[model samples]
Target: MGAWFTHLILQLAAILGSSLVTPTPLVRTDSGAQLERDWGQQVRLKHLYMEGNSRHLQINPDGHIDSSHAQNFYTLLEIKAVERGQVVIRGVNTDQYLCMDTEGNIFGSTTYREDDCNFNEEQLETFYNVYHSPRHKKVLSLSLEKRPYIPNRELPPLSMFLPRENELPMATYSRRSSERETNDTDPFGMRSGQQASPKLSRSSRG
Candidate 1:
């Protein structure tokens, strides 16, 4: 009788142990209309020119998404509604989720293993959408241009969103620099005293 009782107790303990380790399934309500009103279908994130560039955000082959990539098949994503105002950004092509970690770097996740990947989709008063990760409460942005020739090890783990400029400084700078170089140097590789003008005179026009 004592051996049988011991065996029963062991079985109960094993059952309890299994229950402790088991993860509880997420229970969702049938709020179809509510979900539709809040979360739209799969969409591509286009960079707001007022906030940054006009490029579209896309996940690269290495499993990182940024604004440097143009709108394409791999860049398309779905925004799924979660608890509260939070949501998950999933890549339609790769079937991975856009999640952040404790260090505040964003990456693609195959599973919902960390809470950092879930973000709060806060609509700013400026009518722009900002994604805030719960881990560090920092907003994610894709404003940096990709340098493909650069080595991966030398690159930063995450790219930061640059603030919007009234005019494109890079483009303007390149143009002005080219003009100065042309004006300073002649085609024969000699220093010119006067600026070279491409416009022809009226007599020369004939």
Candidate 2:
């Protein structure tokens, strides 16, 4: 019985030690795979181009949203994931959050109001995706005539936008520090002194 108890004690200690060890956390790098990738990163939304009506979600310095011309500086925005299928849009240049009022007024504000700014981001069967204000049942559209306020049922072609990478995502434009903690232990997220495999990513289906 004493030998059995001793063996049981060692087994329990081994289990406890394993539990204390932290597993590698899944990281979303710039070259992250689809399943591994997540939002809360900066991206640009580009609408279908027309001669007079090229639209991009641009925030003015005074906390106003414009869908007119694609302003290089102001068109960069960040989509932060709040919960599944929900996100909040914020302007990278103006430091403002994109919001929609119940009266169908689309604007940007320095303050973030959860209800006003929470939007449902969904990818369509096609190449484009859409942002809809679920609370107000309004679609954030970029129509040439009346912008950012179409009924969700209408589903205008211009309302959908293609996600694009920021051309010049500099540290100067961001609030966060430029420093990313180096993984001295294992930059490849594994044990050291082994043959490095080719950088891998999961190809996402369209």
Candidate 3:
């Protein structure tokens, strides 16, 4: 009976042509969506340029988002794909995560909150992209007044951002320089002392 079973298994393997034990090949395609498709791959965005004022979106050391006149160190952002089509952005100079509120207010947070920090990057018709928060159901926008712009259901031009690639800056961010203690008892205050997002495999500090 054992010999008969072995012969049957061998016959099945022969008929299958070794496909049962062979692994399927993975084919990867590259395009403008490469950044979103490449999960865990980090990218340093030199200029998150918005067309409204022709200024770069800068995350200040105090965890505030503002428009800048030129490409500065504060405007340097390191973005990584957390999931397919979803990314978590961080300010390379301030050690803050780019976050958005339900009111469409964009800010930076020391602690990484998936609901606030994780954004679905949507590519627009103009070859630019707009970040949409699935949790808040709001889009990231910039006002001409250099303040937070509340976005309506209709995606405005202010929501579009052109990501241009350039060399990463050599300046390192000092966490100690901008450390602050705050309690998150309320829903608005999400700041905490976490080194990185729990979903990520490695430390985000680096």
Candidate 4:
């Protein structure tokens, strides 16, 4: 009877230990819609101008600028570095444009268009291939004219420029975990302390 009771207690302790040691599974909702929403939220549209010509620019899904002149004049929108390349131009009007480099050199104006319309992905890619090719390094370094303009009214903040869908929550898991941790740590403000265990001294060891 004594051995059976000891074994039952040991089994219960083992089961409890295992349950305490196991980690809880992390659950995640559909991230595809979240990703799409985040991407759309980061999209920024701007108007670019060079040499008295202006065009509306949109940041494409691939993170490249879809310049209004992309289809008609691809050479003008060629970017050097794929990662850090950002389409920079003087506001919606005024001519004098250049492709800004990571090193701060603004390459000269390569193309110009009167109408600010019909720019798309296909045209941007074609232009990127032709003028930005390895063999065209010399043309990429040319200096273009520069024009400056001030906005008539204060431009809205960048956050306001983002689409509405992107404004939705993007980080649900972290938020949920944070809330859970907050609740678990001090649910009732109960004090946590260490329990004392009697220690044997050298003199008492004998």
Candidate 5:
């Protein structure tokens, strides 16, 4: 009985240790393939192209690719994020909307418009409110349009679907020492990096 109890205790300890050491499962696609990690944080679609005259396309991030009709116009594809932050979708001659969440629910659609540059601020605000909710939950949906002037076959590849490396809409600033060589003169007429030395000298004299 003593030996049996010792063996049971050892087994329990081993199980507990294994559980603690196990790692979380990495995110992956339906086919068990690994996706780009950086993208999961900021979802960006680089480009989307259509093969035929199809006016609409649906991207399912969790859907499987049909091997036999993989290239067909009706074929569905999953759009995964290549970066972090909120997913942004843009397209030529069309307006697009996205609905997705961290839980893997994603839906998108597009519609063509004559003035592609038009900005719908209200729609954008609503989108943000939904995506940035407290639950961090996302809905799956999209709205897009194809321009009437452009031929279906000649429509340019949708570059707006994917995020551009240079598309960040913000800027950053850096500090410069007074002694550093710069184009702009300081407002107070002190040379770059000279202010520190002058202050030090004055302090020593005092």
Candidate 6:
């Protein structure tokens, strides 16, 4: 009986440990095949600027978001994972989150409002990130057109879907700095790095 009890306890422990393993948030090629070790690390994205224009995407003090040459704090972003593939890009300086309206207009908001700001961060062949909104939804992309940034729903000509004036560009971004201890943690969970991962499960009682 004693030996049997010990074996049962060992099995339970192994299952618990495996469940506790936290996966990384960053994807190597968006294939979801592999994950980087930095799950909660902070990262910066510089817009892929053209030759003569030297600017990164920034949110102005008035809450106007546009590409700018300045590489200040306003241009820095903290990526917050909302779910498996969805993330919200919040401006480090303004503390406001970036979201899109139903009309596909891009803007910054102080809080998340469901479909308004959530995006599927797609890594394209050009290595730039494309923030794709939901079906019948749109985001301001490299192509400044009215078309939604989803597959199969784009215009037939395909040229209209190409990068346009003031649209986000392919090879349009370069990532910088995976700072330590910058991960956003749950109020209930131990501080990042102290815990193997953030809260995988939640309770109402708290």
RMSD of each: 22.4, 16.9, 10.3, 28.4, 20.8, 15.6
TM-score of each: 0.46, 0.56, 0.61, 0.22, 0.18, 0.52
Clashes of 4: 6
Cα lDDT tens digits, model 2, 1-206, are 99999999999999999999999998766433223335533332322222225566677787666664554767876665665667777666566667776655567765555666788877656646677787776777645333343434447445676666666556655433123214633221222311333221122100
Each model's C-alpha lDDT? 0.48, 0.57, 0.65, 0.27, 0.28, 0.49
Query: What is the lDDT, from 0 to 100, of the residue 166 in candidate 6?
Result: 33
- Write the residue-wise lDDT of candidate 3 on 1-206 in tens digits: 99999999999989798766778787666554664434436444456888667878888887768878677778887666666777778777677888876566677777677777888876766777778787876777765212232433356557788876644445343343224323323211333333344532123322
Which of the predicted structures, 1 or 3, would earn the higher TM-score when compared with the native?
Answer: 3
lDDT of 1 by residue, 19-69 (tens): 889688887675553353355433323222224445555655456766543
Residue 77 C-alpha lDDT in model 6: 62
User: In model 5, which regions exceed 4 Å deviation?
Assistant: 1-35, 38-83, 99-138, 141-206
* TM-score, prediction 3: 0.61
Name the TM-score of candidate 4. Answer: 0.22
Local error of candidate 1 at residue 109 (angstroms) = 2.1
Candidate 4 structure quality by residue, lDDT tens digits, 122-200: 1121122111212112112122422221223221111011111112233642353355334443321112201221222
lDDT of 6 at 72: 58
8-80 per-residue lDDT for model 6 (tens digits): 9999999999999997787465434113312233333333232223456666566676766645566666565
Order of all candidates by TM-score, from best down to worst? 3, 2, 6, 1, 4, 5
What's the count of clashing pairs in each model shown? 1, 0, 0, 6, 30, 6
Instruction: Highest TM-score: give the candidate number.
Output: 3
> Which scores greater on lDDT, model 1 or model 6?
6
Q: What is the lDDT of candidate 5?
A: 0.28
Q: What ranking of all candidate models by lDDT puts the best one first?
A: 3, 2, 6, 1, 5, 4
Question: Any residue pairs clashing in model 6, and if so which?
Answer: 48-172, 55-68, 55-69, 141-168, 142-167, 142-168
